[model samples]
Target: MSSISIVPTDPQRWPLHVNAGVHHWQYLDLAASTKQPQSVAEKYFLGLLTELPNLPVASNFQDASRNGFRFYQKLQLNDGHWGCAYGGPSFLLAGSVIAMYISETEIPAEWKIEIIQYLSNTVNKDGGWGLHFAGDTTVFATALYYIALRILGLEPTEPLVSKARARLLELGGATAVPQWGKVWLALLNLYSWSAVNPIPPEFWLLPDWVPFHPWRWWVQCRVVYLPVSYLYANKVTKPLNPLLQSLRQEIFTRPFEEIDFNRFRNTTAPTDLKKPLSPLLRAANVLLRFWENYIRPDWLA
Candidate 1:
């Protein structure tokens, strides 16, 4: 965070030259952290820091293959696992934060600072964030991100937090958030358990021949849903911490008592429902609800 001083011989060109070098180093550091090449860093920064140009042509297949191998080399982690960037769908951070909290993992202060900085730097011009960095403002997306900031210990009354919370409340608050949002809020004790759709892990025990067995879903969806169903079946919630107490006010449109829990089981934010629900999926939800209330056994619970 050191400041740079510029001495300009030609005032018109000075700002451009100084700004270029400043951003070059900034992205250079980011590239170093991820083991990306200087050229890749330049391309990223120019799109934000300047204009982006078309990519250079590869002379032959061998040259292209060599470049691909170098890129893969950069992604290799020291511990032998591969490191990757997961950038789409910003709501993933909320789940990650909640999982870490539930597992009693402490996030480093430096990471907290960078997380805040990243959010601040990327906020939309109207003073809210979106579902993805490139998406439009959304209730579920903005609310969850604001909640994450609060959990990281920002004051509710902080200007950025207040603006985001106000936007969320205006957009119909936690009740209007999607299914995933409800689950995260419930785990944090910000919303009631009844607000969420039933997710029973015992569903995992169903025979492979069962048409709706959990194994038949896409792998990413099934794996995360498995743990989530286990927690939901047990009604797992962290003991009410002070952050949870404040979130009760910060995230809701109405008093906690007035929210109609049953009304929102199928509720999803407009931004979240870009794809229409399939008839098959809707039928599955109906069956899951029936099982959750009447058929799930005590042994399973």
Candidate 2:
């Protein structure tokens, strides 16, 4: 098994100067450095835990509160904040890896090791991942994570990769992934953008008073779709490579050439679809399709 160490940044001047109020930690392998954090607070708490004595339960509210503070205070950083591992949503990391792959960014060896470890740990018993670690498996996560691992240099025959591919196929393959998953695969040229429902950049130009204006969308939806609409309008796709070709063959139930991507744009996996597309939304997609075919302006695109 590979070895890793938790490395924390120096913080003597924390909450004051250039390094003030900043607390960061990194996971580095033995080759990078063997040094480990020697935090006084960590040592104190760890020692305390090792030799903790059972005493009569706190008799008063003050004693209980004080004891709780004493235990927790050691966990606080010099920057006057506590740290936590804030992971849950599974798509973000996969999406990031896809982006890096498209940009031809080389992933560090340590990162690749850690990423594989994380995926190995989180994959469901069914041999796929989910929207989160605890959720049921979905094509959206399984497909993207499968692609990410391949991009990280895992062979298709690798045990985990093969297992995930089986799960992806069982879920109706990559074409059954949801809208966002389609966009990501489309970026890598693994899926055709034409199959994707239109996200018109023109919507962003609509007045704020318009009921369905982009600005009227929830903040998360607004920010994400703004750039997504632009990409959709332009139909950006990476130049294909041998790996992409192999992935195309691997991810779909049918031959890549025979798979009608347009047919799958709206064909989300039953496991992944929380709610069916609304009739209004369906009608809008039809109009947008028509516009793309004839009415959409080249300059705007």
Candidate 3:
């Protein structure tokens, strides 16, 4: 089957299969080089395999105009935009599976197949997945989805599982994942909470007028920070199970017990650090960590 290559604006990062057909952006060729990422707002397509059917020649120009309008109407949605799958990211898969598991909803067999298919079809040729299917393979994306697949009951014996595990190890294991990946693993209790950088929820209590107020951030960033901070503030985590315990051993490069989790709070793999953190943000995190660990007022509690 022919496929489209997506390029994002950043040229180094594009989430594979964005709102599929809705776009005013460019296309990219995934086969051009799997390691080379697309522009943040790009999506390239391959040559067409078959000619599309054309509308019959209209009796007159008015008839042709009416037919075109009718065709356009068929593609419009209730919201006045065409709907597309946007179903191609593996990172979203973990979040979705977690939400469903928490809500006690039953995901159908077809959904499981779709998720696996997306992952299989989009992972880098080296057998690792990226933050987006079109992006470079990363510890953060690889680890979360590795855990997601394990949770979905894929066996270790599966070839896909074997290749992914190899890729995870090659990337230096779970410790190399970024902060958000650490949070997800911590929530599952598969990784220790201490490894995560501080996310003190008291920031929420900051006055709105403050220049650095969380609300001043982008909507997705602010929204994610809020819940994660709340969860971190309370050190929230789930009970562990046999499968997770097994994963602890499987997904890491070093023996899980011997590695120092505290050392990696801000430690991300080289490839994943697209934008280096500003010293200002790092210093702030260090200071906040101290307060989080020892000096915060009980009233702030």
Query: How do the residues 213-262 of candidate 1 rate in per-residue lDDT, one tens digit apiece?
Result: 88999998898898888778888888887777777877887777677777
Candidate lDDT scores, in order, read 0.68, 0.79, 0.71
> Can you write out model 2's per-residue Cα lDDT over 169-233, one digit (the tens) per residue?
98889888899999999999988888899888888777778999988879978998998888887
Error of 2 at 202 (Å): 2.3
lDDT of 2: 0.79
Deviating ranges (above 4 Å) for candidate 3 = 1-72, 79-82, 102-105
Please give the lDDT score for candidate 1.
0.68
Better of 1 and 2 by TM-score: 2
Worst window of 10 by summed lDDT in candidate 1: 8-17
Ranking by lDDT: 2, 3, 1
Candidate of highest lDDT? 2
Each prediction's total of clashing residue pairs, residues at least 3 apart in sequence or on different chains, is 0, 2, 18
* TM-scores for all predictions: 0.74, 0.81, 0.74
lDDT of 3 by residue, 149-257 (tens): 6666677776677788999898888887888888888887777898888888888788999998998999978988998898888888877778767988998887888
